[model samples]
Target: MDQAITMNKTSFGTATTGKLGMWLFIVMDGLTFGAILIGGLGLRIGAESWPAAGSVLNVPLTAFNTFLLICSSFTMVMALNSIVRGDQKGLVKYLILTIAGGVLFLCVQVWEYSHFIIGSEHLESILKGAGFTGSQFLPTTGIYGSTFYATTMFHGLHVLSGVIYLSIILSMAFKEKFGPDNYDRVEIAGLFWHFIDLVWILVFTVIYLI
Candidate 1:
């Protein structure tokens, strides 16, 4: 009976092993991001003074980028629905739009990073010109700069990874590899993409908007 039960066991829960593994990975990754953000928040709160995000960063531009990511998440949903409904053309269209959004988001991030971190003027000079200076809130603002760059870059890396993953899935989708009969791969990719979007919402709130 034990051997039979073992042989019959296919899932740890309602999810198959692959799905379960993905969920576990998402959970662990979430915890890692949470730890970093919380530590940054603690440092910010404990500090004597921290620069306002608006003064140090381009809030409006980032807000637009955030909008793009939200739109991408919606397109991803449409793509998944298209596959489930066996609308191959619709799936392809939405998947391409989603990838386009991801690419645009990354491009904007690169521009932002370059504007701040890699320009003709040092970040310190730029910050000083923006009215943030001294030890309180310049480029040399110690923990603030460290935490901000660390968190944003880590999230950017995830965005890059998600784009590559979605692009591969999109290629498979163009070949009609997903349909109602077998769309688990599309669903899995959607899950990861949605997670990336959700994490960005948190990062935008904490790091950019406050």
Candidate 2:
């Protein structure tokens, strides 16, 4: 018996659809982040005094956080590979590591927030710490510091939420809910996880490093 099956020039699968949707969200979210980042930069450029991110925030501590996120990305890829290889144990291992990495990253973010104080005090601290003898720094300056705090803190909240979601995904995967035959859900969660990691890369560079 001879049968002929035609393959389409463009074959769209679930992964394609999933990635498309994620990209749409990223585009829209990028616009929002861009506005915030640009506004922060503009205000920073036009300000009398601005706290240098690297100086204020402990780069060593943050570097550890960045490593945590990078490790999570690797763990996510390992999870996907495990699923494709039909190795359930490896899938669980990678997912558990990923979740742990996210948790550790969030903890580092929380620790960073300790350096910040309430309205007037935050400025006082920033000024005093950055070699200011007088009132060189003010919290009311173009709302730059506040906006920076708001945007980055909000992203931290999102990462926390994503970690919770990933934990649930790991729990399900451990129960054998996902395997080689059914791993789209895992991939979808991973897409969001990787997006968080990708977004942090931008945030770290724009907000922290640059």
Candidate 3:
């Protein structure tokens, strides 16, 4: 009986060290994002003219995107919980749902950028090249578009990367590679997922509605 207890799994699938490594990567990423946010705030502060965040960006759409991310976070937790409880089916279900949510949010972002941001930037470049100088590219021309594109797009790329990470994790999950005995892997993924969600909430408040 003593040997049985000793034989219990010591290396949770990928080891605790690997889990901690993933967490460290997340913390470092948070720091990098914090730097970008601070830089933007500083730029705004020093400017004689600052653009408003609510003018050009679509507030309603951003609000929807914010909700989508929040829901995905919940789904991530559900996936982790299911795995720990040995319910592989539930785990796969929630993981797929979370991935779908991320994809939907990304699609919305692409459409928004296409309609308001990417198009504008291309237009600006063309005008500048033609010597038809204009301030349309300037943040103050419309506060919403400028900061919206800057902050959200910055964070959006992070979300895109995160989704890719989650997709890989989910693939392993679907193969029945992780379960109640090996829950650490899902926990690590959960950490990154929640961090992405938190960052988006902050971005929405500071860059879209504020």
Best by TM-score: 1
Q: Could you give candidate 2's per-residue lDDT for residues 1-210 as a string of tens digits?
A: 011111111232434677678778868877877787778778778877766676555677777898899999999999988886678899999999998998899888776665444334654666677655443323333355565576677678768877888889888987888765567678878888888888888777877787
Tens-digit lDDT string for candidate 1 (108-134) = 988887776554445566577655554
- Specify the highest-lDDT model's number: 1
**Could you estimate the TM-score for every candidate?**
0.85, 0.79, 0.79
**Model 1 stretches with alpha carbons more than 4 Å out:** 1-13, 120-126, 129-141
On the 0 to 100 scale, the lDDT of residue 185 in model 2 is 73
lDDT score for residue 60 of model 3:
92
Global Cα lDDT for candidate 2: 0.73
User: Which is superior by lDDT, 1 or 3?
Assistant: 1
Ranking by lDDT: 1, 3, 2
